[model samples]
Target: MSDWIDEIKSQLPAGRVLTDLADRSSYSFDASFGQYIPEAVVQAKDKEEVVHVLKVANRWKVPVYTRGQGTCLSGGPLPVHGGIVLDISQWPREIEVKADDLTVVVSPSVLTARIDEEAAKHGLMYPPDPSSAHVATIGGNLAENSGGPRGLKYGVTKDFVLGLEVVTPEGEVIRTGGGTIKNVTGIDMTKLLVGSEGTLGVITEATLKLVPKPPEVQTLMAVFDEVRLAGQAISKTLTSGVLPSKMEFMDKACIRAVESFYPSGLPTDAEAVVLVELDGHPEALEVEAKLVQDVMEDIGARETKIAQSKEEAQEMWHARKQVSPAIAQIKPTKVSEDATVPRSKIPEMIERLRGIKEKHNVEIVVFGHAGDGNLHPNVLCDQRDQEEMKRVEDAVEAIFEAAIELGGTLSGEHGIGTMKAPFMERELGKVGVSMLKRMKDAWDPNGIMNPGKIFPEEGQKLVLRDE
Candidate 1:
């Protein structure tokens, strides 16, 4: 470790490499509590420096992990192998908004919201607005193929990524896709690396597609007597041809949690709530808003309120954004799962999640992008309670199984990092899992780039064993 650290230090600037335990501990984990201290952390300033670090690590047979702001909830950035974490948040950010081309060229470390702000200057916008946009890097967003409230209408990060500059596992740089709108050039490597979660390559720069900013926007909140009614309302809204930019849901438990955090006049007695946002021309938005309201009322919504101003709309969104933190306040630890199903099956999936909570005797707060059928059922528990933690794990597995059975996926935006890699086989059949492993081997022949993640192991271990 000392020899490798010295070699890396000699290659880069004097202070770019860090081995201090305090700094190392800071890079150990992401937003999730999972932690694995790396032997060293290097904050790379340029693509050349990243190549230097990767080449040295490859030569020394040391594991290398790339990280952004460390805000990953799926543990994608966790340095589980404890070798080197190539912190990319320090990389230079440059956003070039080419209005004529309807695209933007941005550095990997650029914040998602900053791109939107910059695009807005040119009357344009990038629509994959993840909840963590304020802090998450564009590179991390592409790595996970992140989606958020707007995904129901504008789609996810993958839809907007037109091109990328990536560094392969062998420290070779390559460009995939470009500023052009359409490309049928080759194997579509850009899309493949977009959601590979750094196991395939490190994204240094990206070209993102942009759309015209909507002239008008409106938000509406509908309260339901039961959660199923809210789900039905969501189905009705989509079926009615009103493509809301944001369609979110929160159950009673989640609403109460948010109320406790910010008593913003949320209906405490309601069993469920749906927050919807429409963006387009004012005349069209008005028509769509009425259609949504009528559908919600027809679906048995107890009450509905439409935001009259942008400030009120922001306030409504603030309540939804407070969910994770609010649930965290209920317990020291939280296990958040992003299981998505068919839009029509959301109610049934929610019911199954309720059953899991009752069976395990644990509190589960549910909320997420209802229109897209992505639900985040967060199980709050104390990690110190061994027995309870075991039950939580079992409950999570049951939830994943239920989602799969309902034609859903184990994850919506969060990649299959170490946390979900064990269940990759359960989601993807044996042949499917093997195919993924073969692809990983082909890309990373030396098995050095973020190993033990996104692929099932050979011995068929159901869980990852610390090496």
Candidate 2:
């Protein structure tokens, strides 16, 4: 063991630092591709322990990859470099809701859904509810700036974050933003670190903004015989003055997979289905629901069904939540990519996805937050087949190109970890990426904070198959 490892163990509790291969191997990979073993794993429970671990790692010029629940779809917590895996998931969970101020102070280890559950006690709501909120930690959500179906109307995780208590890469403690809703004291460092994928600093604590719970919510499911018409209906409804709190889309492949996996009463025969949720006053929702129904029908929807009761509405959303696990059962390997385009270009983007699927001969199931144009086009294949995996890689690259070509982005909710790093320059341009690199270099001078992420290596390309 190195002096740094000894120092970390000495500083933290007796059982906090794990140098055994079994423990290290457990922290190797996350939800995304690739696996890398770290030399040591440190479970820091509090801010002081985090500071100590970072100080020792920084002094030793060792890479420190901070991780939460390891539920990141974009590979945010994968420790690609062999150094220290700073595991924060073991930290004690803390959630303090200030009802009067409409804010919540929480520890990094708190489950993302717990914040909203606590807020609900005070008739308040935390809007950024990611699908993995029940399993994911707030630290990981902040690191990746996660999004959910509600993101179409409420925005992503970054929008709800009012402040953060961060531990710098060099082990210095600094507070950015505050508990207040509006703070223009200086630079917006909170926004910078929120979506940075943990390259700049490690978040110890955070203050999140909360909103009042909606009085009523109505659910609507629109069936389409054609995929293009489904895309067109999404754009038309958003423009028709009825903004839904949640607008999700599912292709026939996803619908069938969900039905087969969990038996959600979804129409497998339809080409596509658009699920809509409108929230607000009951009277307004009643008016908005009708408007949305009319818009869907006018835009070529074959049928529109409105949930008659809250239980029915819950079932609809629950079925949508099951899309990920449902589709996973279709194939042994699922390559989930979130390539987002503009609302007006959604129809075209779907067309491009179809073309890419046919051209590459890959099985792709489309489903995601359609109102925001963040589509999750998943390619299902057997990774053991090298030839098919190669085709999947090419198909993934084509998806990225199509998004950028249509004035869209490489990722909307998922952060650009190693999986999408190679295509960063394509979306941000050379100069734009260079500016980001300069900022990253300044914040992490030793490059010890989560290296080999966001920025690609010289010849790195999208490789899913084992080399």
Candidate 3:
């Protein structure tokens, strides 16, 4: 270990190799509750530094994990293998907006919201707005192919990423895609690496495509007597020929949690609430808002309120964002699952989640982007309680199984990190799992880039045997 550290330090700038236990501990885990201390942390400033570290790791046959801002919810950046963590936050910060091409080239460390703010100056917008957009780096967003509320109408991060400057496992720099709008020359390597979760390669820079900013925006909050009613209302709104920029749902458990935290006049007794936003022309927004109101009323909405101004819309959205932190106050730990189904199956999916909670005798606070049918059903519990933790794990497994059973997927935006790798084969059949393994082998033959993550090892024991 000393020899390897000395070699890395000799290759890079002074103080680049971090072996201090305190600093190493900080980079061990992400937002995930699961923790694993990395052996060392390297703060690389440029692609050359990253290449040096990778070459050192390759020589020592040690695992290497790359991390951005460490805000990953899916344990994607967790260094469970006790190796080296390549921190990319020190990478160059550059943003170049080309008005002629309607595109932007940015470094990996650039924040998603910062790009949005920059693009706003040019009357353009990068529409992939994940909930963590405020803190998540563009590199992390591309690695996970992140999607948010706007994904319902605008699409995900993959749709905007036109090119990427990446470093392969062998420390070779490669460029996939370009600034052009159309490219069919060869394999779409850009899309393949977008959601690879750092397994394929490390992203150093990205060229993102931007669209013109919308003119008008309106937000509406509709309270329903039943959770399914709000789901049905979402389908009705989509079928009404009015595309919503954002559509989200929060159950009564989530509503009360947020109301207690904020006291924003949320209905505590309502079974569910659908928060919808439409962005476009002012004349079209007014008509769409009215149509949404009528659709909510037709679907048995108890009360409906439309934001009269931008401030009002922001207030409504802020209330929705408070659900996660507010629920954390009720328990020590929260196991949030990003299970998604077809837009039309949102009602049934929510119903199955309720059934799992009852069967396992656990509390689940449900909320998420209903426009894309991506629901976050969180299981709240104290991790110290042995029995409760077991039940929580069981309930999570049941949720995934139920999701796959209902023609839904195991994850919508959150990648299959360590938490969901055990059931990868269940969702993807034997052949599909084998194909993924082949891809992993083809990308990183030594299995050094985030090992024991997205793919399950052969003959590996299940994490929860009882479940």
Number of the top lDDT candidate: 2
Q: CA lDDT, every prediction?
A: 0.88, 0.92, 0.89
RMSD of each: 1.9, 1.0, 1.8
TM-score of structure candidate 3: 0.97
Give the per-residue lDDT of model 2 (tens digit) for 1-467: 89888999887877878989999999999988888999999999999998998899899999999999998877888888889998999999999999999999999999999999999999999999888899999999999999998999999999999999999999999999998998999889999999999999899999999999998899999999999999888988888877899999999999999999889788889999999999999999999999999999998999999999999989988888898889888898999899999988888898899999999999998998899999999999998999999999999999999999999999998889999999999999999999999999999999999999999889989889898
Candidate 2 vs candidate 3, lDDT winner:
2
- What are the per-residue Cα lDDT tens digits for candidate 1 across 1-467? 47988988987887879888998998988876567999999999888888888778888878888999988877788887789999999888889999999899998899999999999999999999888999999989999999998999999999998899988888899999998889999899988888898898788899999999999899999999988899889998998977899999999998899999988789999999999999999999888888899999999999998898889999998999888888889998888889999999999999999999999988898999999999999989988887788788788888899999999999998878877877898889989988978888898888778876787555633231222
Better of 1 and 2 by TM-score: 2
Please rank every candidate by TM-score, starting with the best. Answer: 2, 3, 1
Candidate 3 Cα misplacement greater than 4 A, ranges: 458-467
TM-score of each: 0.96, 0.98, 0.97
lDDT (0-100) at residue 45 of candidate 1?
A: 85
The global Cα lDDT (0 to 1) of model 1 is: 0.88
Candidate 1 ranges beyond 4 A from true positions: 458-467
Q: Which stretches of candidate 2 lie above 4 Å from their native place? A: none
**Candidate 2 Cα deviation (angstroms), residue 77:** 1.2
